[model samples]
Target: MDFVFLEDSEWKSLGEFISTKWRNKKLVILCDENTETYCLPRLLAENPDMLSGTEIISVPPGESSKSLALVEQLTLALNDLRIDRNAGLICLGGGVITDLGGFLASVYKRGIPFINVPTSLLAMIDASVGGKTGVNAGILKNQIGTFNHPEGVFVYPAFLETLPILEKKSAYGEILKHALISSVENWNHLKDIGELDEIGPKEIITSMQVKAEVVQQDFKEGGVRKILNFGHTVGHAIESWSIATSRPLLHGEAVAWGMVVEAELSKSVGLPLEQFVEIEATVRNLFEPIVLKTSDLNDLISLMGADKKNTNEQLGFVLLKNIGNPVFDQFIDSEKVLSSLKKVFEL
Candidate 1:
């Protein structure tokens, strides 16, 4: 609920910011191997005292680490470490770290305070702020999770400097999705930006504001919030499938491709052809399209059926009517969904 954005590479400001509230409390640092190496050093350097009484738990990086088994391992580790109800958790990484850590904090001791220090662009813009935390169940993305708001969210844009190129590109999918569902002005602004790699704090803050406003209005995701999932329903399926098959597409990579497929679906289901073509072109230009084998299409469809958003044995999706406009809870038939997939994959 509380958000702070940092401009520099050093995390001293963030360390000082949270120190007063958490200095005496038991602290747990939930991070991935990537962040532990690339991002954690700055925090420790800026505030040596910050990690004094803290316990650091590092998981392997990437979506594969977000699993029930890891959760069980983390839970047991937390118990063994004797982190109690009054403990505070600091989630210091990307989407996987924030999602798994937030979920752990929610379930541990029936809930404890946790602050998100989002080091990845995707987390800063989407995952870390949403209060939705969970891991994949088998091949289904976010099939198990809870709605638990963080005590605070610290955003340090300097972390972007160390981010891998692919990861930054992946984050653009969410940024594009945000623009599409936000306002025509937002979409236009992003469209005029020329290059995704050139996106700066201004653009990131604009996307965050759009997301924050929607989250403030629909925290529980019962209505308006569902629009934020415009690309995720299909995106998650492709992500989970990639993870299961060892293809390992980044979350935003799958999302970029999903937006393309879903745009095609929207057209098949009556979205204006002109709008769909423009949407498809924009998304395709922003991200490299993921190629799904013909044989894997059925499995992707099955994965989608297992999405948490689905209801009453139907596939529920958030689709676009146009840029900056989303229609949620639309049910599309399997055949139509297949058609869309084939359209995107060229199968």
Candidate 2:
């Protein structure tokens, strides 16, 4: 429940904070190649003694690294490092780092304390704050993860300036999804921002708060939390299928496409046509259109069938009634799903 929003230069403070809070604790830094190169030096310099009694482990960059095999590798490495139950994990990178690091911490020694130092905008707003941690199970996104909250979360906005443009845009997808599901005010606020790259710490804080409020209410995703899955149902499906069969889409990019598809579904299900179009247009403005062939739709539909959100073999969704309002666990007919896909792809 602890989320700290800090300036990019403030990341150096984290070393001191960890030293003071977790005195005598073994420190294991879980980073990706990207963070090791770009972020680790700053962290090490700020806390000159930070590397002492610390084991730095680097996972390969990208979603491909989120696998059971890598988890085993990390687990075995931690064991070899002789980190006991008093050890702490510091996830230092983007969503992939937080997800893999957090999950590893949760399972090692039946659960240990972990901290998140999020570098990417996407991780700052979503993955870093939430305790949900896991690697992808096969083609499915986060099919195996635990709801293990971190001891703390530290977000450094400066790291975002180093991100590639597409990475920032991918992060924007989650922020845009937050506005769509939370409030008309949030949606309108973002519409005024124009470009996604223009989003700053203030905007990041706003998006993080939206998720924080939701996670506080439904930590285990029993009821109200399901609304957070608004775009993820189809989003994860497209992400999983694409990674397994074709070029992989970034998590946020796939989610953006999911919102587009679900927006169409919302319109067909009797949401006010005007509101649906407004939501669609706003999302489209932030992200470019994604092209999915008819064949892709078939694979996507099959992928959706295996989504964790499905119950009793019925594919469910969190669709919008209007901006700031969402309806969860709604089932749509397969024909309607196909029709929506065709509409989205203009097939």
Q: Write the per-residue lDDT of candidate 1 for residues 1-347, one digit (tens) a residue.
A: 34555454556656775677776788889999989999888777766866776799999998898898999999899999999998999999999999999999988878989989899898888888878999999866789999988878887888888998888888898898898888778877877774877788888878888888899999998899998888887898898888766468887888878887888887745678877776777776777667668888778888887442342345789887776778898888776787788877788
Candidate 2, after superposition: displacement of residue 154 in Å?
0.3
Q: Once model 1 is optimally superposed onto the true structure by TM-score, how far is the C-alpha of residue 24 displaced, in angstroms?
A: 2.8
**What is the TM-score of each predicted model, taking all chains together?**
0.84, 0.88
lDDT measured at residue 57 in model 1 versus the true structure, 0 to 100? 93
Candidate 1: regions farther than 4 A off = 4-13, 237-248, 267-274, 290-303, 306-315, 338-347
Residue 276 lDDT in candidate 2: 72
Worst 10 residues of 2 by lDDT: 306-315
